[model samples]
Target: MKAAVKRVPVRNPANALTVLRLVLVPVFAVLTVMSEMTDSSLRIAACVVFGVASLTDFADGWIARTWGLVTAFGKVADPIADKALTGTALVLLSWFAVLPWWVTGLVLARELGVTLIRFWVLRHGVMAASRGGKIKTMLQIAAIAWYLWPFPAGLAGVGPWLMAAAVVVTAVTGLDYVFRALALRRSTRA
Candidate 1:
């Protein structure tokens, strides 16, 4: 007689945090788009929402590591949530005239392109987030936060520069991932 193997369901607090962050994306977008609200109020609200949502990105990883709750779902959900939040913010900001459309488009293109590459690599094996990727994320978050706030009296000229730096880092890290993925494919073929 063959023994039956039990399949364990994947669920974790980390994934829950990721889902929470995903939910916040729309709320942040709505607040950002409503023109009736004062710029100061909108800026404060956007910052609060973005900060809380961004915190989940870190909190989920910490919870996963601390509780031994890492799972494939967490791996997938975390990055998706990150892209949704950041990408949505960038698009909404551009729509509201807080930023130029080209800036947001470049960021989105890098994010989506890298995401596709990640899915392709997943068929082979896990490719964990790199240090460069982490730096890019931090720079992106900082840029978004600065852009959400009112200019001049706040961070002044720092916002646009930070956003441009983030875009550069995003492109560089994305190319690095593409190179790695291609190398993996070549090695596997050989």
Candidate 2:
């Protein structure tokens, strides 16, 4: 007789961190809006919230993989939570005129396209995150934090440079994903 497989619970600690990240999104947004691009204390608060949320993004995946608590719910919810947090921050930054609208638009477009590609190739194969894609995510997080923080005027210039690098990496990684997804789908058909 075959032994039954033991299932990992959906309510595991890794998933809890993902949920926490999702919950922090709106709080971050609220604090950012209240800061109005000049209030240092509120901006600092918002920055702290953003940092904590970003850390959860890192921690959740680590905990899930390390502890063998990966679940179907985690597979779906984790990316959704990540995108929501990122998209919200980009939008807020653009709204405050701290970052260009085009920057947000391009990054978000690439992100949305990548997400669709994932769904498109889901039946064929899982498209793991590429090194370039991982770098793009880290660059984006760093750029966003740099912009969110109430840095001194001299240091303020660094955020734009970081964001420019992020945009280039984002576009490059997006094209790579598209090509890989097409290949994945084609190979599965053979």
In the range 52-134, model 1's lDDT, one tens digit per residue, is 99999999999988877877788888898999999988887887777899989988998889889978987776677899999
lDDT of each: 0.85, 0.95
Error of 1 at 105 (Å): 1.0
Instruction: Itemize residue pairs with steric clashes in candidate 1.
Output: none
Model 2 misplaced stretches (Cα beyond 4 Å): 1-3
Over 4 Å off in model 1, which ranges? Answer: 1-11, 35-38
Residue 58 of model 2, lDDT score: 89
**Looking at model 1, which ten-residue stretch has the lowest summed lDDT?**
5-14
Best-fitting candidate, measured by TM-score? Answer: 2
TM-score of each: 0.89, 0.97
Give lDDT tens digits, candidate 2, residues 1-190: 9999879999999999999999999999999999997999999999999999999998999999999999999999999999999999999999999999999999999999999999999999999889998899899999999999999999989999999999999999999999999999999999
TM-score of 1: 0.89
lDDT score for candidate 2 against the true structure: 0.95
Clashes of each: 0, 0
